[model samples]
Structures are given as structure tokens and as C-alpha cells.
Target chain A: MINLQPYENPMYFGYLLIGLLPIIIGMLYEKRFRWYETLFSFCFLVLIFDGPKLGQGIALIGYTIFEVLLTWGYVRYRTRPKGANKTSIFVLAVILSIAPLVVVKFTPLFDPQHPSIFGFLGISYLTFKVVGMIMETRDGMIKEFNILKFLQFLLFFPTISSGPIDRYRRFIKDYDRVPTKEKYLELLEKGVHYVMIGFLYKFILGYFFGTLLLPNIEKIALINGHSNVLGLSWSLVGVMYAYSMYLFFDFAGYSLFAVGISYIMGIQTPINFNKPFASWNIKEFWNRWHMTLSFWFRDYIYMRFVFFMIKHKVLKSRIAIANLGYVVLFLIMGIWHGETWYYIVYGLFHATVMILTDAWLRFKKKHPDLLPSNRFTKVMSVVLTFHVVCFSFLIFSGFLDKLWFGFR
Target chain B: MDNVRETVLEILSDLTGSDEIKANPDINLFETGLLDSMGTVQLLLELQAQLDVDAPVSEFDRTEWATPNKVVAKVESMQ
Candidate 1:
């Protein structure tokens, strides 16, 4: 009867913390109770998906079973070392693992009224994990698979909805051992701090930017829609900053909670944000912002593409290969977001910026004397990068879609 | 040995953008964030270009070739 969306409000945080009390105590005593962790994950998952959202809950269960069986089958075959793992077969398995998520994402494009039955909250994030595991297994990075461990990794409650997507090996290392009390105390200290920061970000500042101000700003931006050649206006600028702030605080706040809880459980899940706003260039920005997700993309998508291109002699130069990889990577990211013109444009925008950034960095490398390396220039770069990122977020906001369609 | 150390230092410095990078055999480049999988790719490419130590990317893991010294040894073994 107790159906709760995870971290939906301040009250949800209280409930979560209260529920985590036992785990906190267990970690303090230097004991990692795996069974207890599993039990809590299940209960909280139920709270999130039962009741009105029971359809999603059921979908999650079926989807998990499919993924686990698929991964198990792949790992068993891979472990044999002499198995004929054909590329086409492996590709089919990957597609099968992603089938549910792909349907969930694109179902509404053709028929908005009938969403896919397999759809559920966190499907995209979970698919990322499943697909990642399959690829890593194909590469022989994961030697053997255990069903329970695979399930636990996929359903790791805190990061299930959205992730600082943890790697399989990195996760196993943390889950398999209990930290010493001294180290756990350190973890606890950081955990508490992260949660406090999260409260400020999500509950306080996010409410101000998203709940209190965004709607009013949207009204103004709409009113001034046709005042410029590109339909840009001063009010539109406000929407950009407000929306970017809201996005950062809300998402980063969720990541902090996930990471904080993982720490309390002695799982040291990776951090997601690292002062993303302070980055000096687009490459550095990717390194800092939603770090786990970007790194996942880098490792699984971008890096693999580049490696494949080089190995097969698909491109002439290293630079060309990297550039092509960036385009394909960001375009896929945009598509993964949703099948919308704005999202696709947003992806192309980032790809262009990165390509330009690479060129500039190469040029700067050659002519270090031409571009002054003063604090002023550094500040200018940060400010410019910040605006560039904000403008991209504006495209991502789909305000243009609303504007062009004359939606009030 | 000296040539390998110099080659390692050159690759490490370029990737990290640190002019002061030292060729300390014990220093773990991965832990220091100077090298990751992408950097590993770069290092492998550089090694082939400079020293002709070629190996399949599938055959290597980051943890095995985590440090500069290990990387040097890996390249040497391949040769």
C-alpha cells in the first residue's frame, strides 16, 4: 500500500534515510550485509513501482529476467574460450538486450496514446547497464557471470532510476568487501556532506529555479518569441539559465543521493558531478559533468568507435577518426534522449563544438605565444564555454519546438 | 631501457599536459588519472609509431598495464 516514487520530495528523503539507518549501523561496525542490502533494494523498488505504477513494476521484473538470462548465456559461452562467438550473433544478443528500451523510447513517436507495455521508469539507465555488461563480456572483461550478482548490479536501488552508471568490475570490488571502520567513518562523513549538499541543491535551489521561476519565465519568453530574427530574446536568456540551473541541481542532487547511500552501504559508487560549471573547455566539461554517464559513453560508445575505426582503417588520420566518433556518439546520444528534431540538433551542436574545440586546441598547441595564457583569458574561456553549453541546453529544452509550433 | 623510459615519459607528459612528469617506474599512471582506456589507446599507438610494439587491443587490460613501468614491460614483451 505504500507506493513512493524514489526521492520525489523532501519527505521521500526522510523515509530513505530512515530506511538506510540499519545499513549505516552495519557499515559502521565494518560489516557488509549483502542479504540486507538485497532485501532493502527489493522493498524500496516495490515502494517505487507498486500501486498505480504496478505495470512498470511488472515490466521491470520481466525485463530483468530477460537481461539476466541473456547475460548469463553470453558469459557461459564466452568463458569457454574456444566458442565461436560470431559478430552477427553477438550483435543480435546486444540488440535483444536493448529491444525493450528501444521500444519504450520510440513507441510514442508514431502513436502517442499507446505507450509501449514494456516501458517503465529507469528503463534507459538499466539498458545502459545491461548493454554495457554484454559488450564488456564480449570483450572478455567479465570472466564469469553469477545471476544474483548480475541482478544486484542491475537493480542497485539507489542508482537504478538514473546512474552514475557503475562498471561491473568496479562495482564488484566495492560490494565484495567491507571497509575498515576508519575508512567507513571517512565514507560516512563524505556521505552525510553529499546529502546535505543535495538537499540544498534539489529541495531548496532547484525549487526556486524550477518550480517558482521557470513557468513565469517561460511565459515571458513566449511573449517575446517573434521579436528577433532567430526568435531569440532577453527573456529566452533567462529561461536558458533557469532551466540549466534546474537541470543541474535536480539531476546532480539525485546522483548525490545515489552515491551517498552507496557509501553508507560501503559500495563507494562513483561520483557524478565535479563542479561542471567550472570547466574551461568542452572536453573538460564532458570530463566533469555527469561524469559517470559521459565516461560510460566514452568507454562504451566513443572509444570503441574510434578503436574500431583505427583497427579497420576506416579513416585516414587519428584526428578524422576521433572527429567522426564524436559525431556518431553525440548523434546516438541525442536519439537515445528522444526522437525529436531539437534533441537531434542538440546532439549535432555538441558534436560541432567538440570538433571545433579539437581544432582550436591543436592550433593553440602550435601557437602558444599567440593566445595569451593569463587569468583574463582563462576566465574568458570559462565564460564562453558556459554560454555555449547553456545555449545547447536551450536547444535541448525544446522551447524552439513550442515557439515554432505557436504553442502558448 | 633509457630509450623506453624516455618514450614512456613523452607519451605520459603529452596526455597529461604536465611538463614536469617524471619517469618513475612505481608511479601508477591510472590512479593518477594521467591514463585511462583512451590514453591506453594513445600510448599503444605511440609505442607502435615510435618503437613498433604492436598487440591486439583485446589482449590488453588497463589494470595489467596500469603504470608506466608496466607499459614499458608490455611493449618490450610484445617486441
Candidate 2:
């Protein structure tokens, strides 16, 4: 009857560390305790989906079966001797992989109070994994289908709720081998460091920014902006910065916990953030912020879009094609976040900025003297990019919708 | 095979807009900022168009195709 959300509290880490000890010990002895690791993952998964969340647990089971079968089927088709790779079939498989997530995302629009039957925590992340697998299979990159390994990857407890989204091949390599003692010792050191940093970011700074400060700031902003013209006030700027900090600390902290725990288990799950605020441009920000997700969007969505455009000769100009790809990528990203106007706007805003940044870079290349590369310019770029990103975050935060139209 | 290498190096240079790819065939294109996700796409498209080497975008792994020499080898192997 015990239900636990991932990294929900200090107690979760206590349980996690205790559960990881056996695997850690086994790794130290140059053994991968796969059975025990599987057992630990199941137990933790149960804790996450038990009690009042039993429906979601059931949903997750059904969803896992569905994805596993879909991936297996696709791989089998692709790898079959004399199999003809049909575009329609590949497209259908990808669509099927995303169907549940689409339904889950759209459910709220139809019924505000009721959760979708297909919905589960981390469904989006799971969908990303399945879609990635399907795409790889299509590309002839994923030629083998191992159902058990697929299950393990999909159900990896540490990153189940959210992810630094591990790739199939990258994950399997780590899963199949026990790291050398020295390497594991290093992993242990870094893992411990990351978890400690996560604690500071999530429990301390995240708490201070999100829990302690956000509500008060929001209240003040609402009060001051409610009567102001177009509900605009300086207090809203306070809301923007506070929300941005909270978003970064809270999510980055959660990501660190995921990555650290994966490290402890001998899986080198990718890091999600890399000093994102230091980015000099919107394009660079995507590279640093929630890196795995952005990279996913980049590789699977953006790159593919550009390739499709070029292959089909949809646009004559490469620049125009690149610009259109950004629009398509960000628009899809926005819709994936949810069916909201602000989210769409946030997507378009990023798309426009990315295009402009590309144009500026090209122009700067053409006229290097106009914008000299100095420390001052570098600082200015970062400062400007940070505020631009913060403004996007404000739009993402949905405070504006509330400020303007009183919808939270 | 030499033609494949030369062609791939030319494509890399064109896509990156830098002759450094040819100058240092072993340089990490990704790490050195010479090639990126978009650049990778362009490279694949150019390769497909020029050499008739049908390398899918998804098959373009960074680790496997990190350098001009490796890319040339990959193209040759595919051929």
C-alpha cells in the first residue's frame, strides 16, 4: 500500500541507496548482478505505481506490453531475410508508437478532471525510447531484437519517471558489461558527487526557489498585475526569474539524481544540463538545456525533417529548409508539451529566435568587423541569450495566460 | 576506394565550410565544432547524392563516423 514518486523526498534516496548497494557491491567484484538489478527495478516500480495509482500501474503494464511487441515486430520485419523495407510500414510503426502518448496528451482537453486511461507517469519518455528504437530499426542500426533487454531499458527504475533519455545501443553496452574496478570507483565518486549536488539543488535551492518563494511571488505578481494595464507589472518580471530558477534547479536536480543513480548501477546515463544559461544563442541553449531531450528533437525530429526536405527537394534554398525544420521541430515540441496556446507560442518563439540566430551568425561571418569577438561581446551574448530564454520560460510558465486572460 | 575517401573529404569540407577536415583527417568533427546535427544531415544527403552511397541519417553514429578518415572508410565499406 506504499506508493512513492521518484525522488519525491529524502526517504526515496535512502531507499534507493540501500537498494543500489547490492548492485554496487557486485560491480565492485566485477560482476553485473542482472537478476538482482531486475528485481530492484521491479520493486521500485511497484512502489511508484501502487496504492491509489494502481490504475496507472495497470496502464504501464499494458503500455509496456504494447511497446515491447511493437518494437519486436518492427525489428523482426526489418531484419527478416528478403524483407522489403516499406516506408508506409515504417511510418505506421512510428505512428503506432506515438499513438498512446498522443491520446494521453489530448485526454485533458476532452475531460478536464479525469485522467486518460492510457496515461502513466513517464509515458512520454517511454514513447521517446520506443520511437527511437523503431527509427533505428528502420535505419538498419538496430538489427537484433531482445525483448528482455528492451524491457530492462524501458523499465530502468532510476530514470523511469523522467530521464536523461538513454539510447538503446548506448544503454545495452553498459548493461552487458561490468566496469573495471578503477572505472567503477571513479563512477562511484562522481555518482556520490552528483547526488550531493542534486540534494543541494532540489532540496535546498529548489525548495527555496520553488516552494518557499514561488507562491509568494506569484501572489504578489497577480495582485500587482491584476489592475495594471494588460496585467503587466514589474512583479511579473520577479515571477519570471523565480520560475526560471525553480524550473532549472528542480528539473536539473531531478536529472542529476537519475544520472547519478544510473552511474551507481553502472549505467552511464547521459547528463541533461550543461550550464545552459551560459549559452550564447538559442541554438546553443538547446545544446545545453535538457540535452538529451533537445538532442532527441535534434536528431530524430529536426535532422530528419531537414533530410526529408532536402531528399524530396521541397525547398531550393538550404537556409530556408533549415529554418523550416526549426519551425517543424519546435512546433512538434510545443504540441508534445501539451495542447496549449502558450506552449505553441513558446515553441514558435524559439523557432523564430533560432532562425534569427542563424541569420545573425551568417551575417557575422560575412561581416566579422561589425561584431568583434571580445570578452565584452561574449558576456553580452550570454546575458542577452539568458534573458531571451528566461522570457521563453515565462511564456512556458503559463503565468502570462493567467495575467492576460486569467487562466492558470 | 581512394575516390570514395576524396569524395567524402570534399563533402565534409563543403558541409563544414572548413578545409580543416582535409588538413586533419583524424580530427573529431563533432568536438571541434566543424560538424553538427544539421551538418551531419547535409553530409549524408550530399554523400547519397554524389557517391550513390545510401547512408541513412539514423545510421550516422557520431562514434563510428567521428572523423573524415573514418567517414571515408565507412563510405568505402558501404560501397
Give the per-residue lDDT digits (tens) of candidate 1, residues A143-236: 8898888888889988888887987887888888888999999989998888888888888888899999998999998888877657788898
lDDT (Cα, tens digit) per residue for candidate 2, span A1-408: 778889987778888889988988998999988789989999999999999999999999999999988998999999889976999999999999999999999999999899899899999999998899898889898999988899999899889898879899889999998899999999999998899899899988999999999889899898898686777788889999999999999999999999999999889999999999998878779889999999899889988888888889889898998989989999999998989999999999999999998888778767859977799999999999999999999999998888788853
Among these predictions, the greatest lDDT belongs to 2
Quality class of the docking in candidate 2, CAPRI style? medium
Tally clashing residue pairs in candidate 1: 0
Give all TM-scores, in the order shown: 0.90, 0.96
> For candidate 1, what TM-score does chain B get against the true chain B?
0.78
DockQ of model 2, rounded to 2 decimals = 0.78
| Alpha-carbon lDDT, every model | 0.83, 0.90
Candidate 2 Cα RMSD after full superposition onto the native fold (Å): 1.8
Q: Which stretches of candidate 1 lie over 4 Å from their true place?
A: A81-85, B1-40, B45-79
Worst 10-residue lDDT window, candidate 1 chain A: A399-408
Native contact fraction (fnat) of model 1: 0.13
